[model samples]
Target: MDQTLSPGAAADYIAAQENKSLLRFLTCGSVDDGKSTLIGRLLYDTKLLFEDQLATLENDSRKHGTTGADLDFALLVDGLAAEREQGITIDVAYRFFATDTRKFIVADTPGHEQYTRNMATGASNSDLAVILVDARKGILTQTRRHSYIVSLLGIRHVVLAINKIDLVDFSQSVFEEIVAAYRSFAHDFGFETLVAIPLSARFGDNVIERSPHTPWYHGPVLLEHLEAVEVVRAAASRPFRLPVQWVNRPNLDFRGFSGTIASGVVRTGDPVVVASSGVTTRVKSIVTGDGERPEAEAGEAVTLTLADEVDASRGDVIAAAAARPDFSDQFAAHLIWMHEEPLLPGRSYLVKIGTRTVGASVTEIKHKVDVNSFQRLAAKTLALNEVGVVNFATLAPVAFDPFAAVPQTGSFIVIDRISNLTVGAGMIDFGLRRATNVHWQALEVTRQSRAAMKGQQPVVLWFTGLSGAGKSTIANIVEKKLHQLGRHTTMLDGDNVRHGLNKDLGFTSSDRVENIRRVAEVSRLFVDAGLIVLVSFISPFRAERAMARELLGPGEFVEIFVDTPLAVAESRDAKGLYKRARAGEIRNFTGIDSPYERPEAPEIVLEGGTTSPEALADEVVEYLQSRGYF
Candidate 1:
């Protein structure tokens, strides 16, 4: 594609391009802001399109082009059939091209608000962002949202591309006004460089070459600035960190830790510590696929052999002995909720950082950010595309550096345990000091010792169903039967606990999750005290039930589903609560206004409609006896 190179110099051109520094960036903005068009224009001006590709673009443009009789450059990038039909980018599209100076990989991200997750995905890997804005519509909400996400994801460089300038007759005042408004809101974004450029993607104006129409505008063109911008390489200067991805033992004689170096440099004989266990060892050898290496810096994937036989495994961070990353079970972070299902605080999720996945929950939602005003507003849950600061509590401690210092080891993704869908993304701020300060005191008397003294196995029987589904009645009978059998037992009914322990909580979804969380913790304490605890609550969400189940050891927590049809439960209306719910008097009433998620695989399924409470209680006792719970 280089015009200066002759046909005989093809190898020379290829070699020169191979050595060019690569810059990764993305184009993002509000809908109809010409993100795809700008990328298409860049590819076209760089002369990277072949004859067949150009011809296909021309044919597709005739069918789907918004610009009449003009080449629809968007067709080059909007390759999805649905995208062509809807005339909007629904997914992130990436393209590669090279100028004479630098090779580039640009991502054309979607502009619609619903596809904001896709934009965040693109921004996560990019070093710079080109945020397009319609010259007519200045500083829209989506623009601000994307800008906030860009800053949150730690992109230091931004180019405010004011597209469709020709539509506004290339007015300098319009450009200045839009730039001023954007800078006003983005003042706290902390970007190192903010460049403003005016261009019309539909036409060739200040795209690759300077335009004569903008005589008043004297600045480097888009391509010139992209090539000249220097992206900082700060990872190599930070503390040495390598998240152990795999324990490589191809043969019994070879033991190596394989992972890409997350930060800093590692050399042979360097003292490294397992961040979680505090076990120290020296690097005996650095092995790569190509052979041995003396030293490797950040971003290099190598296998490290330790001098001493120390305990190190996947999910452990190997760091410099003098400077170790922080390890904690509790921390605060900023979360970007990406799924349609709102983020509930107490529900259990799988948090994946580096190669380690742990059970985690949002302990509290501090506040959600109003992207337009940059104000923190009180929020109990985070809806789609919402950003919030939250405290996360993991089942076990994880080693991480603050995202500001080392991004690779500091960011995590939240995955739904049931669906395995990525629901949220977050960046670690810092570990909670309280988590580190508080230590678990070693008690001589343990749960096993207490249960042996009582001559019985301690367990939790959890009852969950609709409000009028006989959950409490069956659980009460089960507890009485167990007590009559000379077994130590205690009951924590939902209503009784509400009057004392959970008196301040309500019936909202968030409150229900917290309510179950508190009851689950109390049940665990009772189990530790050598008593069979019966917990009866309509723990509606399966995620919350799963959280409770994970808190206890194997076979200690038993879930009982009181299977009663909604119509039948409402027909009985034992407490007359369903009547108020049906009359719109009570809000968030389960099985009436709110939802009740049925347990997929509960330990016991009691027929509340047909079976008597005594019969159900007998059935539960028989099952527990058969399982050797006596």
Candidate 2:
């Protein structure tokens, strides 16, 4: 049934559609920056409000607005009672609007430094930014920080709204000075364009409509630019690509692949290829919500009918037959550490690229990119919130395109198994094929063979401690105790691991990370073989320890922290390594030089030197026994 939507409904529908030109924009400014007032005024002056919405605002004003100044304009969007009382947005709020020329998806970002993660969440996928800079404060640190984030997120377009012009008496010189400073500072990054507009969002000077008060300004109003500026779009003039999201099989015989076309276009009978298997097939038909299309363009979420019932499922990308995606088990990419935890090399994560997720590890961190200047600094690892160009090698082959070419196929996220949090975001840059001549072969031993050979259940007893602490001694005794219990066990001493499996690793920050990682994986294998694996290492970083704990099932990898004071550890001088570290012989050394983040909680805390190694090892078995691990 064909029906005419009311103007309000039309506006809402257009703003919500997936096919419409949605300009993802973000608003960033500190408290008292008039950011909320600006958005409120824009909605008010644009005639986007309904009578019911306005009536509710009026009643709300009369009921709770103590000052009673026409509903506190900011209250229109900041609807929370606490937000209304405090007059600040605590979280990122998404709102959509539209003018005659274009549609907008505005992400109101938080200003506080502590909420930098929230700000990044909003700006991560933004195409443009509306940086609200108070005319009085000019450009503050928060402004610079938000701008840096916008650039880092690849937001090319920026609209610098020099708000609160009323305070500056509409001073052109002040506005121009601020503009010049911002342009100079921001020109260092990939900010494609910047449009400076002078306006008072509270006074509605240049938001929805132009004001004669600012005669000196010739540019269109805020709404005018919003309606005119094109949201930088990827043209559909490339090869057709679609990552199969789901199999649409309403019946057994009839089947179809459904996904949003990420790029290019697909037409009826067009030659299509499955990315994983490299099998070619022709498109039988294109099914969309609006019936079938002769050709489906980019950004259209449509179900595709194929010529054959080939083995295709989620994660398999379908593209034009002539072109093939980059297929490899390993690849190099730039990663942005998103979680509160630091990223170290050799840590494995489930990499989710498009619909495909696979186990991946960082082989090397080629360099860290300076988001402000886009400089590629040679670094070992990327800390949280730091963007770096790092190389990752996955365990299985996956398809990818360079981020510069395909944003959808190129992007991925890393899931930390410990916290189940998305720790990083990556963009593909290089594809490293599996080496056929490398001759890398994993063991083919059965679980029965390995356990019978060892004589006991394989479990990873992870021991953490400060340098010079009696971790190795305690672990050695623990292995002996386990052997006496008729349980097969192996002592993976920290020093021993550095000489064998982790031989190539060094004490460098990134290398130490990889070192612990190699040991953890070997420990996992020991557990699989039904033998208790005792790992004694500093493993100073708490986050890595958490990862090791998560990799093992509940009570599988037992963390025993050899709790010893730093002074006590330094005084031990068992290996004289702490003395060497104090003499500047070692760099990035834990305890002596580098900071050791102690574990807040561990299964057992054995005092180093104070407790007998035999007693400590016996306690470990008792603890495991209580937990039913024995």
Candidate 3:
């Protein structure tokens, strides 16, 4: 029997010890919603705080900087000093505590509606959730907002913590009414457990210690329910899963893989395979900080050395190989759009799943989940704080399970390399069947042969500018002049290419990068086949264009920057995009919703708006003539 245990710890621990419980959960409501008051009362009444910590709280209360007396529990949840005074959980702050019965990790989340992304982060790995609803108001819009996120993250158990019962007159009828309303709203989510309790977090009514004030009510207190429920163990029982974290090698000759065991047990001589490479090896030994172990189970941090050498490294997962993870290029998944920039297709993002990271893109937007109605809006895009199911296609193969089958393995985050912020979080739906089986056939003409046929060195001329800048205008005249001069050339215009090649793509930063990549590849083939390739596009990112440069030689690639200032380009207004952008009709628009970084040190600078179209075309021809193409 597990001896030293708190009601909170025992229930989660017993579930985890048997590979059952491995996660803890907590919710933060708005600052006015009693989030601090509830957590503070629970710790204070349960005697969890150290004497020094309690002393500090008392001392600080007397000299109070921001929070008041009688223990502002938000202080305990806000792990950062900046957050404590600010009076909000900025993001997800994890805390660990233990009793003799079980150990637990708690996810403390923010309450504001705008920080829904942070809320998603808090509950992403949780097995259970406790939503703090003010007793006086019963349930606010934020309550439903958080609950939707909790359900989306796949947390099974949800406890409706109706806090500040003292303010609600401790009325049993009000509690019942709130419960009924919550149940009705919650019915759409399809959660497993929904337990609503009446309590004043300031007074510690039913949080840990049973309250005599509610003699009329006869149900197990919040603490009793937490200890008695079985969730962690259930999760552990699903399958053996371990996400390879880091390649461990203390010495040159000692090679091992180290990661916290996500699920299941492993013994020496167990056969395992690296998912990325499919190399199979037998486990030679399992070592932990505690000492050498013959067997390591789920949740234990261990270093595993194999009997055979393999190219296993970071972003690779080791598993039974028999139970292969769900694999496909495209699948449906839920997303929390965190970035201010909206989502669009043909954009590439680094998908960090488990320990593996790869290039991925949202190939299609199926629909957005309507927050108010819970109805799915079959839209092409999603904006900030929106929840939606988008189709993702990976550049390389990925090993994963459905977010439902394995939350840790199925989960992923999209990071913006420029901003260095996690822009999105997602869960895969393996059964998200869609049509994406279009085959691409390269043109029969190869670049080396095309260059020989043209009687001049074939090259890719990439022109970039704002959407309406003279890119297409200049590229058209350049192609016509080259045609009349009897020189071989192929012009790939953004608008013409959009009709067939990139028809499926939309206007988003990620999509634009992907669009440029596809166009770049085609240009490389043209250059290789001996034909001069002319490409006109608003290739926005320097990094993406740099990739194009990497694919060709100095002579074979020429970067022509259509140098038109934003103000000048807007005045031109060749298309209505500038007007629409200014009107806020869209978001993340290049030069408006999103920032467009101009090319630095481009091979050629063309004054797109000022120079005559034919003169710009003549300038390119002269450059070609100097290269002996004429």
Candidate 2 structure quality by residue, lDDT tens digits, 1-630:
879899999988766664556677878866667776777777778788899988886787676553357555565677777666776776888877876556788887777665666777888778888998899999887787678767656678889999988899999998899999899888776777789999987778988778787889998888888777776577487678899999999998778999989889889999999999999999999999999989988889999999987889999899888977887887888677877657877776789988888877788888886654556798877776677777787768898887767777888889875466888877787676556458656778866577667554446778888877788878888777766777767778888777788888778777777777777778887777777888888987766777677667765767788887888888987888888888998788887667787777777888876877778878888887776655
Which has the greatest TM-score? 1
Task: Evaluate all candidate structures by whole-model CA lDDT and list the values in order.
Answer: 0.93, 0.79, 0.77
Candidate 1 lands at a TM-score of: 0.97
Query: 1-630, model 3: which lDDT tens digit per residue?
Result: 858889889888656676634447776555567665566655676668998988777775555434445665656666666666566667677766554455567777778776778878778667788888887886777787788888888877988888877787788988888889889888978778888888877767888877787776677777777766677554465556678889987888888889987766788888888777778888899999988889988778899998899887777778875675665567779988888877756556678988877767787888888776778788766788888888888766777888888777888998764455788999887744454465666878665556766688888889998877788888989999999989888889988899999999777666677789899889987777778889998888875677677678877789999887788888888678879888998666778877778887787889876778899889988998888754
Question: Residue-pair clashes per candidate, as listed?
Answer: 0, 9, 28
- lDDT preference between candidates 1 and 3, better one: 1
* Residue-level lDDT for 82 in candidate 1: 97
Worst 10 residues of 1 by lDDT: 1-10
Q: Write the per-residue lDDT of candidate 1 for residues 1-630, one digit (tens) a residue.
A: 747767669888778888999999999999999999999999898899999999999999999999999999999999999999999999999999988899899999999999999999999989999999999999999999999999999999999999999999999999999999999999999999999999998897999999898999898889999999999878899999999999999999999999999999999999999998999989999999899999999999999999999888998889999999988889899999999989988888999998889999999999999988989999999999999999999999999888998898889999999889999999999988875557889999999999988888999999999988998889889988988898899999999999999999999888898999999999999999988989998889999999999999999999999999988888988789999988899999998889999999999999999989999999999998898888
RMSD of each: 2.1, 6.5, 6.0
Deviation in Å, model 2, residue 512 alpha carbon: 5.8
Ordered from best to worst lDDT, the candidate numbers read 1, 2, 3
Q: By TM-score, how accurate is candidate 3? A: 0.80
Residue 337 lDDT, candidate 3, scale 0-100: 89
- Each prediction's TM-score versus the true structure: 0.97, 0.74, 0.80
By TM-score, the better pick of 1 and 3 is 1
